[model samples]
Target: MSTMDKGTGATMRQTAKARRRQAILDHAKRLFAASGFRAVSIEEIGAGAGISGPAVYRHFGSKEDILAELLVGISEYLHAGGAEIAGIGGGSEGAGGSEDAGASVGVGESAGVGAEAREGDPAGVLRRLVDFHLAFALGEPELIRIQDRDLSALPAEARSSLRRLQRQYVSLWVAALRRHAPGLSEEAATVTIHAVFGMVNSTPYVVRRIDTAVVAERLRTAALATLGVADVVAYRK
Candidate 1:
């Protein structure tokens, strides 16, 4: 065979291998999301992927490793997306200013507080928080479900690393909240941030029961309302 032909054959073989690996991960993610980590096995995943039992081991060491990859992969995906959004000038022009206007309105109706609390524009931060969660949650529901449900199955050391990544993700939200709601204590902001996450992430499971178009609209409205941005924009006058 010609050298060029051999090179093309090698490339095709590698592509096929990569596709098989992805197929396994995709099926495993579905199983994990439906049945949780403890109940799913590598053999089941391989069977679903139409691969032999031993072939699964060639792609991943074990089920825990697959779960780790899924969780960490999703975290990394969101982190990268957030960085991209942050770089794109807060997702769009005028978005930051509009967010600030909303925060101002929120402060006007609240109880009296010191100047330190007023330094950060809480409304703008809340808008970014909503945007971030909506982007992340909507992009990867299967991965999110695996991360939330299968995390406890990871080994101690692996769990520690995963926890750090999870904390970093949380810190991004907390920091945004701190900037927007300067008067709010960190503890208070943390709780609100988690609440926002709960509302955003739960949409996937809930929306699946409805039509896709309706689900998208509901998600957009719910995210904006939950983050208090809707009120801010409405009260801008």
Candidate 2:
């Protein structure tokens, strides 16, 4: 048998260790979402991922490790994705990176213009961030649920680190919103951002009643209105 190493977190590695470890993480997420993190056991996680029982420990020390990786993985993924979206080097540092997260990837007004040009308009910037976040909300509902409910189950330092990244993400939106609406005080912008997040995060509940498309549109319009951006309007045919 090939020796098992936990391997670094890179999912693209061509080693079986990397592949099986990723499989464990994937299954863990599905199981954790279906059954709370506390209810699910490592043995079950192994079974779900097609790993033989008792072998799951080789890749992860304990269930808490898996949960920690899951939380950090998503945060880093968002930071990486936000960096990619904003046209920064992958090695770029910080939760928001040097460039704006609202910027689009492979998109620019001209070569070398980068995120600065991509995010030229304030409303456009807010729209891009809203669109990115909404996509995150709609596509990863389970992860969202886990983030909302299971976050506290992790250790305090880990949880605080994850939250600091989240605050940085929020600050990008607040800055962009304030830029678009210069009249808004920092406190007002912060409050509005929280209010819109409250509305957007109620997706699992609100989406049950209306078509997701409809709810998304309403949320987008309402978000712009909350920021007091001019020209906010309903979807026009």
* Strongest candidate by lDDT: 2
The positional error of residue 83 in candidate 1, measured at the CA in angstroms, is 3.0
lDDT of each: 0.62, 0.65
- Residue-by-residue lDDT tens digits, candidate 1, 31-83: 99899989887789999989987899998888887776666555544443343
Q: Which stretches of model 1 miss by more than 4 angstroms?
A: 87-129, 231-237
Q: RMSDs, each prediction?
A: 10.8, 6.8
As a TM-score, model 1 comes out at: 0.73
* lDDT (tens digit, per residue) of candidate 2 on 1-237: 223443443333656776688788878888888889989988899998788757988888888878877775556445554434444435224434322221211111211223642657777656666666666565556677677778878888778777876776666667777777888888989888888778777764547566878877777777667767643345444
Error of 1 at 8 (Å): 2.1
| Candidate 2 weakest ten by summed lDDT | 102-111
Question: Which model scores highest in TM-score?
Answer: 2
Error of 2 at 81 (Å): 4.0
**Count of clashes in candidate 1:** 3
Residue 131 lDDT (model 2):
62
